[model samples]
Target: MNIGTAATQTGLPVKTIRYYEEIGLVTPDRRANGYRDFSEACVEQLRLLAQARHLGFSLEECRRLLSLSADEGRASRDVRALAQQNLEAVREKIASLSALEAQLQRLIAQCHGDDAPDCAILDDLMGQRGN
Candidate 1:
């Protein structure tokens, strides 16, 4: 099929398929006088890349995983380890965000939005704004 057809089959954009070719991810054939001629295997490879990317794998990581597609004894332990590390990072972010939310809520409560122009929130936000 053509490059456009391959893109449609793989659910990737035409530009993305072109970029994959440029990055040595997929190597489709060239027709006489030079048009990209994609094969079924290329479509499958693009689909695999899409799925890997959707699962948060970077391009280099996707390449590594693709290389393992041929390996019968592909050790998935490394993938699991990466996933665990990412989960821990996410949990840390949640904790940090929770603390930030608490601090913001306290500041908001301290801010008495009345006519008297003595703003505690502004003082906390800009330490230069003298209390």
Candidate 2:
């Protein structure tokens, strides 16, 4: 098949598929006419990459995962550890966002939004309120 067929099979954009190839993720064979000839294995690899990206895996992480997936003697624990690390990072981001929400709510509450020029939100942002 061609790159378009591979992109359709994987549900990835043609540009993304090209970028993956540029990044050494998937390598389709080149025909004598200098066109990319995608194999079934290449399409399968693209599908796996799509799934991994949907799960929020970085490209480098996906590369490691693809390597481990190809290893016949790979341990399940290794995959679990990587997933755990990603989970922890997600949790940390959630906590940080929650804190940011709270701070924004506090600032908004302090602002009266009236015709008066005394804006508490600006004061808070300018360090006049000492954060």
Candidate 3:
């Protein structure tokens, strides 16, 4: 199959597939005409990459995961460790976002949102008012 068919199978964009190729992630064989020829196994790898990316794995992390996925003797503990690290990062981001949301809520409540030019949010952002 071609790149288009692989993209359709993986539900990924053609550009993303090209980028993956550029980054040495997926190496689809090139025909004599210099066009990419994706095989069934290559398409399966592309699907795996798409799922990994959807799960928030970075490209480098995805590379490692792919390597481990291909290694028949790989331990499951290695994959679990990576997932745990990602979960902790997600938790920290959620906490940070929660704090930001609280501050934004406070600022919005303080704002009059009327014709008057006295904006509480502006004052808070400019350090003119206490947080």
Candidate 4:
């Protein structure tokens, strides 16, 4: 199959598939005319990559996970560790976003949202001490 068919099968854009190829993720062969020739294995790899990316795995992590998946002798401990690391990163992001949400709520609550020109949100944004 061609890149278009592979993209359709994997639910990834053509540009994304090309980028993955550039990043050494999936390596589809080239035809005599220089067109990319995607094999069944390549399409399967793309599908796995799509799922991994959807699950928030970075490209580097995907590469590592893909390697682990291909290795029949790979220990489950390594996969578990990687998943745990990603989960920790997600937790940190959630905490940071929650803090930001709380701060925004406070700022919004302070704003009167009336016809007056005075705006607490603007004051806070402009580094003013109080409004």
CA shift of 27, model 4, Å:
0.4
Model 3, 22-131: lDDT tens per residue? 99999999999999999998898899899988988889988988898889999999999988887887898899999999999999999999999999999999999997
Query: lDDT per residue, candidate 1, 63-125, as tens digits?
Result: 766677647787788667656765676688799999999988988888899999998888888
lDDT score for residue 76 of model 1: 85
Please report, in order, the local distance difference test score of every candidate based on alpha carbons: 0.81, 0.91, 0.93, 0.92
Worst 10 residues of 3 by lDDT: 81-90
Stronger candidate by TM-score (1 vs 2)? 2
Task: Rank candidates by TM-score, best first.
Answer: 3, 4, 2, 1
Q: Report how far residue 47 has shifted in candidate 2, in Å.
A: 1.9
Clashing pairs in 1: none
Off by over 4 Å in 1: 72-131
lDDT (10s digit) by residue, model 2, range 21-104 = 999999999999999999998898899899988888889988988888888899999889878887887898899999999999
**Pairs clashing in candidate 2?**
none
**Model 2, position 94: C-alpha lDDT score:** 92
> What are the candidates' C-alpha RMSDs?
4.1, 1.7, 1.1, 1.5
Worst 10 residues of 4 by lDDT: 122-131
Q: After TM-score superposition, what is the CA distance of residue 66 in candidate 2 from its true location, in Å?
A: 0.5
What is the C-alpha lDDT profile of model 4 across 18-131, one tens digit per residue?
999998998999999999999998898999899988878899999999899889999999999988988998899899999999989999999999999999899999999463
